[model samples]
Target: MNGFNWRTLSADELEAQYNPRKSVPDFEQHFTAWVERSASARTRLPGAYDLRYGPGPLQTYDLHKPEGSATGRPLVVLIHGGYWRGLDKNTMTFTAEPFVAAGAVVVNLNYDLCPAVTLDAIVRQMQDALVHIVAKAADWGTSAARLHVIGHSAGAHLAAMMAAAPWAGDLGARPQIASLGLISGVFELEPVLHISPNQEIRLDSAMAVRNSVTRFAPKLAGPVLVAVGDDEPQAWQAQSVDFHQACRDAGTQAHLMRVANANHFNILYALADASKPLCTALLRQCGLK
Candidate 1:
């Protein structure tokens, strides 16, 4: 790793850095454990399952409510990441436990994967899903005004996009998102174009710039928590710093958090722990603490 210059690295070198499993040998175990844990959570938790937010077959989510009847609770929408092409919402349901226990309604959402659909289409689906969630808030016995969005990896990029979306005052009933928790997110897509994971999404320069959170001014007025893993590749971790700086440059409240001893896969696990600094900071940002 000596004399490595990320700024001048070749496309292949860049791809290697962005590919976490290549560096971390036990990456497969994380996915295996996530499925087992999430399955147990679904059976133990109480709430609605497979609520459709759009016409697409993959456009559905699981809404886990608090243990008992709790009205007027804040809604925390958790978006899963698979580089926008690889994972499901169910595997991400494990994130619902801490938030639900904290008396916050948690929605684990799914969007159509890439190669099957374009990235822009997925973004639109996320926006549509959120709008539907806000519109159907009363059905879940909660208010939409206290919505918080959290996403990891590719999902984190989408969460930032959601935060930047011009939702405020766009519709009479639209909720003003309270805060954002972007965990281990890839804020800009330009570097992704050269990465191995970009095969499915097939990102072009124009699309990369269009979706990059750092490219435009931050439209979100609420606090934003941009985080990454300390053990991740330098290029991967730099995205958080760049995005946090972009938010600050735009006069928005943003914080950069580096999770110790965590990599791309395990960082999400840290966020699932309520007492962990990552989750604690996010909970506070969402007004849950």
Candidate 2:
């Protein structure tokens, strides 16, 4: 083991080895419950509808429009992260309300999950979804120029990539994203080489290194808020820090925020309220009152 003392490691090491990349407790099941709870939230919020983001019939997204909205409202694209394999956009259905109620449109997106596809395919689908949404933004009644992306976990990772992605010249219609609200997102892919989740994500070190948000930080030049929950595992927190440092080092506007009493799952959940601190910050980022 290259004389490295894996056996003599500390308590953190013991925990890391036993629970590396292990998501916050019951995230999957809790999210499943949240998916069903969308109906309850919808009854109170209303104006929730499904829209097609891509040409494929299966490629659709949930767009949440608030009541009594104003002109040229900003859009918040909320990407739910489930290690790229699990969870649906429904787990994030309730998330758009805060943005919607804040006079911004909220788009909760769903890409093809894993076991049925590769991570590369998922990322491409995500990029295609964003472009398609922007193309439809005018018809959807929002300013396509301004977008505030809020992604949780895996969704955060994809958002980071989109934020830093090179201009795909052929897509046409340049976009203007205002800021990023990345919650508990994985920006660096290197960890997956040793992280068990890679078994399903299938990211080799080379691929992970190339696709890492940290590597493309320079391309992203917006105010980015990398938020995490204090009670979550170290790995979860590290991803935010590493990405923040990369962005900062690249002369981009980026900062880190931690929800004092929350964990991975509830950090994004708490943003459901229009008055929540995270939501308020997102409003501020989008230049809304």
Best prediction by lDDT: 1
What is the lDDT, from 0 to 100, of the residue 116 in candidate 1?
93
lDDT of 2 by residue, 174-282 (tens): 4667788888887766655665566677777677777787777844556998888888766557677778888888888987888788777777667776667776777
TM per candidate comes to 0.93, 0.86
Q: How does residue 236 of candidate 1 score in lDDT? A: 80
Q: How close is candidate 2 to the true structure, as a TM-score?
A: 0.86
Model 1 weakest 10-residue run by lDDT: 165-174
lDDT of 1: 0.83
* C-alpha RMSD for every candidate: 2.9, 4.0
Local accuracy by lDDT, each model: 0.83, 0.72
Q: What stretches of model 1 exceed 4 Å from their correct place?
A: 1-7, 165-174
